[model samples]
Target: MNVLLFGASGMIGQGVLRECLLDDRVESVVAVVRKPLGFTHPKLREVVHEDFTDFSSLAGEFKAVDACFFCLGISSARKSEEEYRRITYDYTLAAARALPSNPSLTFTYVSGEGTDSTESGRSMWARVKGRTENDLLAMPFHAYMFRPGYIQPLHGATSRTRAYRLLYVGVSWLYPLLRRVIPKHVTTTENLGRAMLAVAGAGGAGEHILYSPEINRLAAEGR
Candidate 1:
């Protein structure tokens, strides 16, 4: 199977790319980026395109993809609601519209915990994410939203956001405890990646949304 990956330079995308490259079932991986990712592998290909809002120029490259891992996201830190929606909702929808739709084609979206599916929530970011997830689900292609909380990066996976990286460093020691005590609330990058691959390949465990425990379970099944 072949795959299209967005945000391969980000934390979650990095882990997914690593898993896809290592998996024998994946024949190729096309990573969409604004610039070269500097990583090299036989199965990995990078497509540098600056515009995420308009995929018209890149339509030719977005065809017949068996799976798409949409990990592109940005923190809502200081941005206005419009700015955040542009990145979180508009960019995701543009890519989804560009991708070819099929029953066998799976699209995995990496949302975070507390995402409000109702789209009428108090949290601005969650509402945007909820709307994004809701629209993706309405599409013809198979779609799954992964809502991971406290993701412990494994195998050199690091966040592109400096603040998140610093926070990860500060709380790195609590990963083991969280995994043991609150497995449903915590999952490592490795497990999340494997779980995505599993669902994309097998089309299960994605009735609607997936939390951390379900992700770990799917990963174990895939393994």
Candidate 2:
């Protein structure tokens, strides 16, 4: 299987990229990044794309991929709704439109836990993500929106945001306890990556969207 990935430098993207490399069933992995990740592997390929909103220049590279793991996300922070929407909705949709709309392609989008499907919510980020998820679902590929809450980065997957990194560091030891107690919402990066791979290889649990619990369950198939 050939896999296409976005946001390969981010927290979740790193994990997905790692799993794609480790999985023997996968033949190749392509990551579209703004800069090189300072890594090399026979099965790995990187395309430096400066503009996320315009993918027409790299149309050829998006072809013949069995799956795409799109983790290009950012905290809304103090930015205006338009700024957040540009990155969350516009950028994601550009990539989605660039990809082939085939049955063999499974597109896994990393939406957060509190995404507002109604697209008219109190939260700015949630509203944008919700609209993005809804639009992607309307696409032709076998798409799955992965809504993971409180992901514990594993196998060297680190967050680009300093606060998030510190938070993970502070609570790293509590992960085992958290997983056991609130298993439905919290999932490890390892499991998230494996789950997406499983979905690309085989049909998922008869569901287009997957929460943390379902992700963990599907990831177990790899083990």
Candidate 3:
């Protein structure tokens, strides 16, 4: 399978890339990024473009892809709602618009928990994420949304926020404890990555929304 991947440099994206590379079924990977990903492989191709809004600039280059994993996301802290919306909502729609060429493409979105798209007057971040999720679901591609909470890393770290870094650090030591006490919403990066690839390869059961427990389950099954 050929995959069109975004946010290959980010944490979740890195895990996804690793899983894709390791999977023998994946024939080729086209990764889109703002800057060069600084890696090369026989099966991997990188496209450096700063603006997601103008994906059509490379529309002709958008070839047949079996799936698209949109892992690009930014923290809600230190940004206004409008700015957050542009990144979370606008950029997502931009990518979706370009994937119609890849008929029967499976789209996996990294959405957060507590997302509410009814234009509800609750948290701005959740509302934006919810709206983005809803909008992407409306697209033609077979879509799946992953709403994971407190994603712990598998190998390397790529969090831009210091607070997130700290949280990951704490999670490393407290994962066992948290697993015992935490609800099913929280999941680690390794599990999430494994689940995503499994779901993508097997095809989803309807428009699936995989919460943390489902992710962990799939990851376990994939292994």
Candidate 4:
């Protein structure tokens, strides 16, 4: 399976990329990045894109992919709702539009847990993610939205927030204990990444794959 990835430089993206690289089923990986990925592999191709809002120039590159894992995300630091929506909505739509050319495209989006697409106007981040999720679900291609909570990294912390870093370190040893008590809503970055790869290689049964505990359970069995 040929996979296209966006935001291959971010925390979750890095983990997902690693999983894709290791998987034998993945024939090739095309990364669309703002900066050069500086890696040489027979199955890897880096497409340096200048603008995220427009992919017209890179249409050909986006056309032949079997599946796409869009991990491009920004933190809700101090940005206003408009700025956040632009990044989360506008950018996602632009990239998703290219999937039509590859009719059997499976789109796996990295979405948060609290997202609500009813336009409830509650939390700005959730509302935005909800809207994005709603829109993507309406698209023609197959779509899967992963809503993971407290993603424990496979390696060192990558978040700039000191609180997140400390939490990662603290939970590094207690993950097994927490998994027994906590619901499967909380998952490791490794598991989530592998799940995405599985969905991409094996076409999801329906138009949308809303990954919850059951989906993760199935993914674990295959691994």
Q: What is the per-residue lDDT of model 3 for residues 1-223, given as tens digits with 9 covering 90 to 100?
A: 8888888888899888888888888898899988887778888989889888769877755667788889999988989999999998899999889775544678899997777857585799989988888887878767889988767787784676678777787668877777878858578777877887777777656338888888889889998
Better of 1 and 3 by lDDT: 1
Every candidate's lDDT: 0.90, 0.90, 0.82, 0.78
Per-model TM against the reference: 0.97, 0.96, 0.93, 0.90
lDDT of 1 by residue, 1-223 (tens): 8999999999999999999999999999989999899879999989999899998887777775899999999999998999999999999999999986576789999999999999998999999999999999989878999999889999999999899999999999988888889878998889888988988977644555999888989899888
Candidate 1 accuracy as TM-score: 0.97
Per residue, candidate 2 scores C-alpha lDDT tens digits across 44-77 of 9999999999999887888878899998899899
> Cα miss at 34, model 1 (Å)?
0.6
**Number of backbone-clashing residue pairs for each candidate, in the order shown:** 0, 0, 0, 0
Candidate order by TM-score, decreasing, is 1, 2, 3, 4
Of 3 and 4, the candidate ranking higher by lDDT = 3
State the TM-score for model 3: 0.93
| Best prediction by lDDT | 1
What is the lDDT for 94 in model 1? 97
Q: Whose TM-score is higher: candidate 1's or candidate 4's?
A: 1
**Alpha-carbon lDDT of model 2:** 0.90
Q: Model 1 lDDT vs. the true structure?
A: 0.90
Which residue ranges in model 1 land beyond 4 Å of their true spot? 204-206
